[model samples]
Target: MASGSPLQPTLGELIASLSLQLTTLVKGEVELAKAQVAEKGKSMGLGIGLFVGAGLFGFFAFAVLIATAVLGIATALPAWLSALIVGVALLLFAGLLAFVGKKSLDKAKEVKPEPVANLKQDIEIVKDGFTS
Candidate 1:
């Protein structure tokens, strides 16, 4: 009904503006948290990949070393006996590795999502909103 200074707002108008600003801040923070979690998750995946690579490299290196040792032994013995002995040794090694791997796998726990902390605090805030 009346003109007012452009620099000043009525109480209700000021409250509405503050509420909107608060909501924007909350949403911005939520997006930031999501981005940070995604970045960290990517880094964790890289770390796991490096760990697997190290394990595979070690396995291949050990196999190479064993092959070199077996070649040396085969040269000293008769050809037929050397081949048979090496064949049995390799089969036994394979079986033992398989058993150990199975045991380790059986002892592993399945990965599952954990419940997020602070969910109770979020619920409490919502409950207080109804009361207020």
Candidate 2:
């Protein structure tokens, strides 16, 4: 039974079928990548939210500890002056942390320019093909 006798595909038809399958495979891969990226973004958002909540609770706990320390020291000094001293110290510490945090955030903002450069190089390579 030669191809096209109602049994097998002809060579042209086989090529056309292969092309269609390749297109479908590429489309399916692109869709899978999109779904994975979406899921990762959702997980990252939830993780960031939990981190923020934990940081807030940690700050509250620190405040309570500061208050306790101030109250403990009040027996040796006047309560109001003790509180004022502790508050000033805390303010100075907070300012230092803010300064360091600002520097850290600035560094974070500039993280990994190399990845972008590499992506651009990859685009150029793809555009130029294997010649150079």
Candidate 3:
């Protein structure tokens, strides 16, 4: 038989060849996973950048709307007084939101997760069993 004949590989040679193929397959899979993750990360970054741009535009639009309201009110009241009224109203709304948020946070602080409570009870039962 020829030295290079496929039908005559030694056991050691066959094992070596299998190991090389497995190594190559694993390396290829790792490379593919890295490439997929990189593509997803790029897409996520772009999406986040677009969201930030949208938020900035929304903020400008809100400022413009507030300006329009001030200008509309200026038709009846002095410009300074109208601006002050709008500012005070905005502060009051912000304060109300802060109060509600604080209350919600306080309520959240009072609550405990069931799993944590169960775990603590289980630990105490184990301790009691050991003591008894």
Clashing pairs in 1: none
Against the true structure, candidate 2 reaches a TM-score of 0.66
Candidate 1 lowest-lDDT run of ten = 109-118
Query: C-alpha displacement of 82 in model 2, angstroms?
Result: 1.0
Model 1 agreement with the true structure over 22-106: per-residue lDDT tens digits: 9999999999999999999999999999999999999999888767766777799776666677779889999999999988887
> All candidates: CA RMSD in angstroms?
10.0, 7.7, 4.5
For residues 4-85, write the lDDT of model 2, one tens digit per residue: 7657778888999999999999999999999999999999999999999999999999889999989988989999999999
lDDT (Cα, tens digit) per residue for candidate 3, span 1-132: 336567788778999999999999999999999999999999999999999999999999999998998999999999999999999999999999999999999999999779988999999999999999
Q: How accurate locally is residue 122 in candidate 3, as Cα lDDT from 0 to 100?
A: 100
Segments in model 2 whose C-alpha atoms lie over 4 Å from true places? 1-3, 94-132
The candidate maximizing TM-score is 3
Question: How would the candidate models be sorted by TM-score, starting from the highest?
Answer: 3, 2, 1
In candidate 3, position 49 carries an lDDT of 100
**Ranking under lDDT, best-scoring first?**
3, 2, 1
**Local distance difference test, per candidate?**
0.85, 0.93, 0.95
